[model samples]
Target: MAAAVEDFAPREIVSSRGARITVRAVRPEDEDGFHAAFLRLSSESRYTRFMSVVRDLSEATLHHATHPDATREFALVAVAGDQIVAGGRFVAVPETSDCEFAVTVVDDWQGHGLGRALLTALRDAAAVRGYGRMEGYVLSTNLAMRKLGARLGFSDGPMPGDATTRLLVVVLRGDDGRAAGG
Candidate 1:
């Protein structure tokens, strides 16, 4: 596992359509804004991100989202003005040098490159942590994600026993010029 990283420097990025957004690690004070962003997501947007119909985030899930374990998990948020516009995270897989990633952009921010920015951050962070691989499970109908995954060098295939889901994976190399896990 990687060492605890309490925070990261904030970065400013321009969306494809020229919107300025700041990307930063999630903080405790972001809970309310994060929830508001979720509420603003259309039902279809929510379903695509969650792969299920989630009207609201559970208290436990909300807390966990805002408070990632410093050692094995990293979460980030993209903010425009005072509101959250996107978020992403990667959680280490137990006993393995691999991480599972998830990313979501609010409906209005979709198709504007926020998701790409967050996913890139997660992938780079995991690589820096010496993770061997990063993987994501996306719904089969999510063509945007599939295309993004492909463009980012992630290979995708059907998830075992899940017809509606596809698993995307990319091997990561560490500073030593070798594949991370083995």
Candidate 2:
């Protein structure tokens, strides 16, 4: 069997709300918030984001997504009013330094800039760690996400065979004024 990679948990730094949410590193303490965030996800939003129904997300599943090791993964959560309303992750491809990313914001929080913040945070974090680029496959129906990606420097193409999806990639140069990492 292959050696297991370390799991990553986001460290809460702070929220734009001025409320303290640590983005420093993820810990076991985040399990509950992680679960609740997924549970609270509306079915439609879940489908939109995950490209699946997301009928149920067990604790193990949540842990797998939220708690990857910092070396291969970087994740962040957005919290306000004692709940994690948003979060994101970037998974480093083993064979290369590039990464793939996804961001989520609870339905009520949609259009509230939380998604943008989460993406910016993850992109900067990836760049700092020496990732030269990042990309994602988003459903074509998710014009909002596509638009957000475009605003953040993503370009689009057909997701080969799955016409409903669009693939996009962007380079993340360190010191690039484009990222919110500073």
For each candidate, what TM-score against the reference? Answer: 0.92, 0.81
For 1-182, candidate 1 gives per-residue lDDT tens digits of 86244646789999999989999999988888889999999999899988989999887888888988988889999999889999999999998888999998998889999989989888878877778889999999999999989988899999888999999999997567586454
lDDT string for model 2 (1-182, tens) is 11112323444444444555544334457788878888888998899888988888887877777567655777677777678888888888778767999988888777767777788777766776667678898998899999989988887889767989998787775445454343
Where's the lowest-lDDT run of ten residues in candidate 2?
1-10
Enumerate residue pairs that collide in model 1. none
> In TM-score terms, which candidate is top?
1
Q: What RMSD does each model have against the real structure? A: 2.5, 5.1
Top candidate when judged by lDDT against the true structure = 1
Q: Give model 2's TM-score versus the native structure.
A: 0.81
* Per-candidate count of clashing residue pairs (backbone under 3 Å): 0, 18
Q: Would you list the C-alpha lDDT of every candidate in the order shown?
A: 0.88, 0.73
Least accurate stretch of 10 residues (summed lDDT) in model 1? Answer: 1-10
